[model samples]
Target: MALMIISSVVATPSGNKDISVAIEEMERANYFTFVMLINMVPPNLFQGNVTFLMPSDRSLSRTMVPAQNSVMDLLLRHSIPSPLLFDHLLHLPTNSMLPTSNPDLMLKVSNRGRRSLFLGNVKIVSPNICTHGYSVRCHGIDGVISIEKPGLASPITCPRVASAAAPLPLLAPPSPSPSPSSAPASDPPHGAAYETSGGVRPQMELALTTWMAFVWLLYSKAKLCV
Candidate 1:
């Protein structure tokens, strides 16, 4: 893949004449960028001449594509699925928009004449850049048709943007009361010393474990227990 030189029309379907020379014809007229992409494509895949609704260097540059494989997809999107020429365009009426190779994209033709050709909102600069056999009418447009810019999104391919996090699910919590249970009223062995008899201890019913301990101590003391 030279990425620059288009070899022959032998790569074209139906054994069309070598349009590579015609591509040069276009290049001489300063319409090289669009034609060059056509040349980069292998002959087997690229069949015949079709009207190329070309975006100018300015239009192509405006596209913020990653410097990688995505460029290939962008190229395919610009090329129409079928072979069509300017003559074909003349027959089409106003507001006639044709679908391109890409499902998202569509080529629109309006205001067609010997003076100019309009694709979508773009003005076609070079009519019949390579119109010998099939045709490669290169048009110079103001901007490229961005199909996947806003709509196309996949689970994996789309970016993990900073979207507002979903509200968390409410959860159930435990009660504040400790386990309500009574303990046996019995004193510990003689050696054990307990703090009591003077006044009532604080109603320290907090965690389950603390509540249990309070109950056990209260049982050990006979009256005024804890």
Candidate 2:
């Protein structure tokens, strides 16, 4: 943004004047709110040859001030970048569009004879409040011009976000099965003859041999007696 240095000078009838004089005229016109608003602006702004559309005291008092970011936008909407007086504006045909400091907004002129002149929705109640200088000009308007936000005029669209797909979960391995041959053996009953390694029991065989020998001895004794 370029800086506008306002230098004060007296306004001559020949279209030569200063910005400070114009501001003084605004104070005299009972536009205290409008004057205060302009004073709030930094010295570096609204620097070039400019025109101001000031709202009346009552109009400014009733309306709330715009936010800090919006204050510049609002001021720009009301002002024309070039110096324009009531006479210059009067020549414009009906529906003539005038550009402001802000490119998005415009001031439309509505000329309806001596009774009324309008810039957009607000009527120029007091025309040419300050025409003392060639660089600065001011006029009193009936109401405040509605400020349209640049963001709202052209809607901002958000780009689509790409999301990554989720990863799959892992599972555990299964256990091995047991073999049938490894099962336990069954138990045997009590008092049964258990199998030995070589032959039959020795006690039964000895008893049979003794009985045979006794029989033989008795036979021999009987024979000798006869």
TM-score of each: 0.48, 0.56
Error of 2 at 214 (Å): 99
| Predicted model with the maximum TM-score | 2
lDDT of 1 by residue, 73-186 (tens): 666666666556667767777666666666656655676485666655556565555555444444445567555443222122232223322333333332333322453346
Worst 10 residues of 2 by lDDT: 190-199
lDDT of each: 0.53, 0.66
Candidate No. with top lDDT: 2
**Candidate 1, clashing residue pairs?**
11-43, 13-47
TM-score: model 2 vs. ground truth: 0.56
**Global Cα lDDT for candidate 1:** 0.53
Collision count of model 1: 2
Q: Rate residue 171 of model 2 by lDDT.
A: 27
Q: What is the clash count for each candidate, in the order shown?
A: 2, 2
